[model samples]
Target: MSATLYYFDGRGKAEIVRLAMAAAKVPFTQVDIKEKQQFETLRAEGKLIFGQLPMVEYEGNHLVQSCSIARYFASKGNFLGSNEQERLKVDILFEGTRDFNTAFMPYGFLGFKEVLDNAKNTAMPRYLPIYNFILSRNGSNGHLVGSKLSLADLGLLEVILTIEELLGEDELKPYPEVQNFLKVMKSNEGLASYLRSDLRRRKNDERYVAEVKGVLY
Candidate 1:
C-alpha cells in the first residue's frame, strides 16, 4: 500500500505514526503542509481537519485522528499486539498515555517556564505514581503489561519522554523501571535510527531520544 502521512511540516500529534512507519521499515511518503497558504487550501478543501493532524492518506482513504493512525500503521507493521488480551493491554497503555498527555496539556504550547511549573506541580506528581503502579502490576520494572513490547510501552515511553523534556532527563528518576525501559528501547536499532534521523530532528528541532525509540522495540 502507498502510505502518505499528511501533517504540518513540524512534528505534532502525528509524530508517533511517522516514527512507527520508520521503525517498521515501511517506506511511506512524508507530506508536510508547512506553508500557511497550502494549509488554507487544504483546510478550505476539507482536507486539513480541526480535531486531527498527521492524518494518513492511505490509498485514497484518509485516516483521521492521531491514535487511530498510529494503530492503523501499527497493525500494518505487527506492532499492535499478537493477541486479543495483548491488544487490550495496548489500549490501556495508549489511553494512559493520552491521559498523561491531557494532564500535560495545560502546560504545553505555553512558554517553557509556565509549562515546567505546571508539570512539576500538577502533571508529573499526579501521573507518575499511576504509571509506577502500572509497572508494578505488570511483572517487572520495565514491562508495562506483557513480557514483551506492546504499543502501551511505546505510549508510556512517549509520555515519559515528554516529562523528561519538560522536567529534564532526571524527570524519570523516581521511576527506575521506566528509566530502564527507556534505555533498553533506545538501544533497539530500528527505533534508535529513527530517533537519530534527520526527519525527527527536522520535525522536533530538539533532540528526541525516548518514546520514538521505544516504539520500534
Candidate 2:
C-alpha cells in the first residue's frame, strides 16, 4: 500500500515529502487537515503520536516530525546518498534546510508577514550566499553532494521556491549560482510537472493565514 500523509491543506512543512515522493515516482494518498478538529481527531486516535501534524502512515508505522518524514521519503526514493560519505553530506545540508524552515512556521496569533520578512531578509542573507558558494564549488550544476540529486538538493529547492513565493519570483537574482542551480533542478521532468500542478501552495497571504489559523485556533 502507498503511504498515507496527514497534514495541512497547504504546503507548510509537509510539501517536502510530496516533492520527495514526486521525485521518487512514488504515488501516495493524503488526508488534508484544514481544521483543528480534524487534527484533534487524529491525535485522539493516536495517529499523530506526538499530537502534531505532518504525520505519515507508512509500512505500518506512524511517523511525525517534519524532518523525519522528509528523511523517510527521501530515503525511500534513494535521494539520501549513494554511500556513507555522500549520506553524511546530505545530512549536513538537509539539517541546514531544516533549521532554515524552523525559523519560519505557523503560529496562530503570530504575524505571518513578520515571519516571511525575517526569513527573506535575515535568514536568506545568512544562508543563501553560503549555499550559492557550495553550488558554485560543485560547478553550479544543481546537485549539492554528488552527480545525482539528493535530499540536500530537494531541501534547497523547497527553500528557493518558498522565497520565490515571497519575492514574486527570482528572489535569488543576486545569488546567481543558486539561481542557476534552481534552473537545473526545475528542469527535472517529475519536479517540473509537480510545480505546474495544483499541489504547490500559494504565497503567505490572507488565505494562508486563514488556513493556519483555522488549524490552530
Candidate 3:
C-alpha cells in the first residue's frame, strides 16, 4: 500500500486511523517512533504538514490533522454514507465525538483536575443527554448514524470506550442506546480482532485510570 502512518505508536490520537484501516482491511506501513533519538529526528523535520504527529503520508502526499486523516480513509473505504444527507449526519455524529474528546482531554490525558471537575459537573451531564438523544433518534437500527457501519460509528465507539476507560463505566449507564451501540461496535469482527491484537495488548494499559474509574459518577 502507498499509505504510511507516522506516529508514536500510541492509541492516543493515531488509533482511529488504525481502526479505520483495520475495519476496511486496508494495509499500510505503520512507522512507529519509540526511541527518543528517532523522535527528535522526526520532530526536527521541516516537511511536516503542521509540525505534529499523526501525519499520514499517502501516495507521496503527507496529510496533517487527525480528523482529516480519518475522513480520508473513511472515504477510501466507503464508510462515509450513501448520500449527502447521510454524510451530514455522519459529520454531525463524528463532530460530537470530537467534542467529547476535547472536553475530556484535560482530565483524561492531561490530568487537569479543574477541567476534569468541570467536565464531570457540566460537560458530562450536558453531552451525555445529547449523545443519548442522538442515539435514540438516529441510531434506531443500533448504528450511530445510518443503518450501517460507518466512521461515525467507529468514532462513537471510541468516545464511549474512552469514557468507560478514562472516566468510568457508570458514565454511560444512563445512555442505554449508546451502551448498546458500543456493544455492537465491540462485537464487530475487524474491530474486535484489532482490539485484541497483540499490538494493542502490548501498547495499552487500563490500570492507570483505575482510581478514576472507582470515583466516577
True-structure RMSD, every candidate: 6.5, 2.1, 5.9
Question: Model 1 segments beyond 4 Å from truth?
Answer: 44-52, 105-108, 201-217
**Best candidate, lDDT:** 2
TM-scores of the models, in the given order? 0.80, 0.89, 0.80
What is the C-alpha local distance difference test score of each model? 0.67, 0.80, 0.71
**Which prediction has more favorable TM-score, 1 or 2?**
2
lDDT of 3 by residue, 1-217 (tens): 6577877545657767777877776666667655555545665775465666677777777777888888888888888988999999898888887777676544434555665677778767877787788778874677867788888887877767767876678878888987888888888887888787754423233443442233221
Cα distance off (Å), candidate 1, residue 166: 3.3
Top-TM-score candidate index: 2
Task: Give the TM-score (vs. native) of candidate 3.
Answer: 0.80
Supply every candidate's count of residue pairs whose N, Cα or C atoms clash at under 3 angstroms: 0, 0, 0
Once fitted onto the true fold, the runs of candidate 3 whose alpha carbons sit more than 4 angstroms away are 35-37, 43-47, 107-109, 112-116, 201-217
TM-score, prediction 2: 0.89
Worst 10 residues of 3 by lDDT: 208-217
Task: Give the Å error, residue 35, model 3.
Answer: 4.6
The count of backbone overlaps in candidate 3 is 0
Per residue, candidate 2 scores C-alpha lDDT tens digits across 3-34 of: 88887777778888888877876667788787
